[model samples]
Target chain A: MSEPIVVIRGVEKWFGGLRALGPVDVDLKPGERLGLIGPNGSGKTTLINCLSGLFVPDKGTIVYDGRDITREPAFRRARMGIARSFQIPRPFTGMTVLENLLVPMDYLGSHERSELERADEVLASVGLAARRDAPAESLSQLELRKLELARALVTEPKVLVADEAMAGLSENEIDDVLALLMRLNDTGVAIIMIEHIMHAVMRFSQRMICLETGRIIAMGTPQDVAQDRQVQKVYFGERAGA
Target chain B: MRTLPFLVIAALILVGGLFLPQFVGNPYYFFAGYVVLQYVVIATGWNILGGYAGYINFGTSAFFGAGVYVAAFLIKAFGAPLPVQILAAGVVGMLLGVATGYLTLRIQGVYFSIATVALVVVLETLIHNIDYLGGASGMQTIAPPAPAWFGGQTQYVFCAMLVLAVVAVVAARFIERSWIGRSLRAIKASEPAAEACGVPTLSMKLVACAISGAIIAIAGAPYAYYASHVDPLSAFSLTIGLNALAMPLIGGTRSWIGPVIGALLLASVQQIATVTISSEFNILAVGIVLIAFVVLAPEGILGLIADLKEKLRRRGARP
Candidate 1:
């Protein structure tokens, strides 16, 4: 509606002459849910990396909150309210679950309440309050994902880009993560969901966009995109045929 | 199993030092004791980058040698006070640490460690070939006001202990509670994930290196003056780099007490063995002990204690 919270214009990225992703344009408004579904090597993760400042696109610019962040370092971008959780949870193995949250909370010094309280609350938000004292190594698959989310949440981010928060999980586990994303989105935080879990992304996303060969081939309501001939031929044809 | 045993050993050293006068009415034991305490600072400093962040820095000699030189040059040239000289160690160490961190932190683990080793060599050559401040022949580092004011060896011991006390307390507090410590732990576990979380991994690595270097340099300042000698061979010696790491591993780099114990035990052995063995054997003994410890106890003495404690706990003794 208003100025998009994130604007990616004509973004082109390449890895050693392999034109991985490209000259694409997308805008995400505040609190909007974006479901980015793409076939393997379709550059979904590559695009997310560009948006999160992991890799600078060779061409085009990234504008966030009325500022061009093309040259800002990843940490500076994070401090400026951008947070992303890895596909595989990386919970600083030596620290407790509570300590993982504390790392990002340090930037909130004098800007909020005590770090310990904020850390505990974030742990609670991710349903990890019970495991607050547990070493990150001891956490199970679901718990590690929760810890990852808690770590990002503690940054009090405007955008939370989760790269495959639910992968290789059972149906029940998928529901658990979907519910968590829903709760995060409900809190007025924009979420960029990059997932291969089709049904989960379709059900959870307010809108869905599908990619094929690093190009956005289909973008519409979940049903419309799913029924679209291009998506069906590329995605469902492979999975269904397999 | 971690640093606890080292604390007990340091206590024993303190108690024995109090009773040492009955054996010799001189400052010899105090001087040796000062070296051990200073190593505690050095090893702890090295561990912030080496053990905590999982980045090995053999360039500790650079910081130690730098401090000794700075202190000597200041006191010799401008007659700067003792406090100012100590501050110089920290400032210069941190600055050098930043350079090392920036250049090497982005590389892999072994490369970073090799960079440090090479850094020591490059820095040593630069200083050894230089002309001012006594060159390779070295300068005599002057004693601070403590021994002169209180007028005895005991006061010097007191001063060394004071520095050790502050260093240990500050180190323990930071590594346990501070934000920098947590980020370091993250980097240690997984750098890619840490970067994804916006850790500024490179900067943090350098900051750790700098602080570690600064502390080691400051610790070496008084030690140089206590010995009243600062040769490039002694201060920037590769052996100093080796000894700095030995203690942290033996005592259990996981905790604050590990390096302290490692330093004290090895120092005590060296001190006692000096009476029976030659000076050349002292450094050789360090290498031997490190090798023996590495072979016999991969987890170090603290890890051994932890294994024993677990056994005792299972046997219901811990209750």
Candidate 2:
């Protein structure tokens, strides 16, 4: 296999006296669908934040595309083709849907196509063409999630970290988003889906890792990880009881 | 190419202003016109950072006062021309803006605003201690004689302010339509999201600050020449800061025209109130209008107009 597109080695993070994530290592390959699963406060978001350059690891190096980018700023990482959607959708308020996509496109200075055409295309791809001129504040919950995905897609990113992209979504809506992400993956984009929904993540990931107390308890194919005793006891067992 | 219309409007306004002194015999009209135009610059400047980026700066007077002092120093030291004084003031204002934005913007939101307010106090104290620029007292300025083409000094200053107002509006409009404006709006909506989307939020904010600071200070440079006096109290008056904030909020913060409209309406009303009711009543009236706008129409007059149009369209469609 080719060298991994992203290599995280010995990455750890601490918030004050509390250790939130790490002493963990992971690798993502090109065009891979990686599911990152963890319980509440189990460091899934923390790990993604580290990967996306929101927080520098207290220790360890994050090499992306063969270069150490552990110290890079979030914006620089974004321009270097690392894009993410917030767990909570943040639509640029007071702006039209088309304008929201235009923001990132304009900043990245990509003009392969006219901005208006590109914006229209993205909006269409996300099934939001009908609402292109609508104010972002006027979007439905499902539409907002689609917008979040579209905003990340506008950069033509190599790695897309979708943080809880399906949380609070109905089962059908989850499937809709899953299908959209799968379609994106078919175009050769690597996606790191950080999710709490087990069935969806299990169905989506070719490889999955379960995080607990800031450490990876299981990492393997979806079936193997699901069948792992520790993953069941620490993740599924608790959910089954609840 | 898109700016052609704005340029044309600016030229037309300039031509119209040049012919103003020919008709208006009263020097008071020019004086009032200068004050209104000055606020036009201030409001437009404030909106660049405050409206576009959602960074509320309470230190408007600090930049304004810095320009006044810069002009005072230039007049005292080298007897610089009005253009030179204005240019120097712009540089100083831009520097202060960049410095302050660099130091405080990292804190974010209300804390950033408080830091800006503190900046005013620090600069005001610094000016108060400087003996050369008339420390506790103020400096008296005798402006150079007006050029032969302009009938008088007031008309010249009025024309100067008109030019500044035009320039400020044009700059604001350009920014609103540019990539910088879109990035600022994104930053305003969500800084983290904007960063993740590839906007250098801090750098864009600093640029906004520098441009805003320079324009506001440019407004103050002419003030020193117009009033023919430089006092720290009047220069850094809370009213100027309040007006700077209020005008943009009242007119609408979405586009460049909002602040211009707000400043024109509010400044004109204040001018009338000062003459008819009393100077004290002028402040009270502004306070009342601002409160009413904030409560009844947070989007300001432009927003109110848009809402009304939407309502009219809906009604027409129903019929």
The best candidate in terms of TM-score: 2
Docking class of 1: medium
Error of 2 at A7 (Å): 0.5
Q: How big an interface RMSD has model 1?
A: 1.6
For model 1, what is the alpha-carbon lDDT of residue B222? Answer: 61
lDDT tens string, model 2, B1-319? 3578878988899889988988888989998889999999999999999999999989999999999889888888888889999999999999999999999989999999999899889988998999998996888887677776767889888988898899899889999988889999999999999999989898999999999999989999987788888988999989989999999999999999999999999999998888888888878888999999999999999999999999999999995
lDDT of each: 0.78, 0.92
Restricting to chain A, the TM-score for each candidate equals 0.95, 0.96
Which interface RMSD does candidate 2 score?
A: 0.7
Chain B superposition TM-score per model: 0.86, 0.97
Off by over 4 Å in 1: A110-115, A240-242, B1-24, B78-82, B139-158, B161-165, B195-200, B278-285, B288-319
TM-score of every prediction relative to native: 0.87, 0.97
Candidate 1 lDDT over B180-286, as tens digits, reads 88788888988866776668888888778877878888876665556667788888877678888887888777666677678778877877787788767888898
* Superposed Cα deviation of residue B153, candidate 1 (Å): 6.9
The best candidate by lDDT is 2
- Between which residue pairs do clashes occur in model 2? none
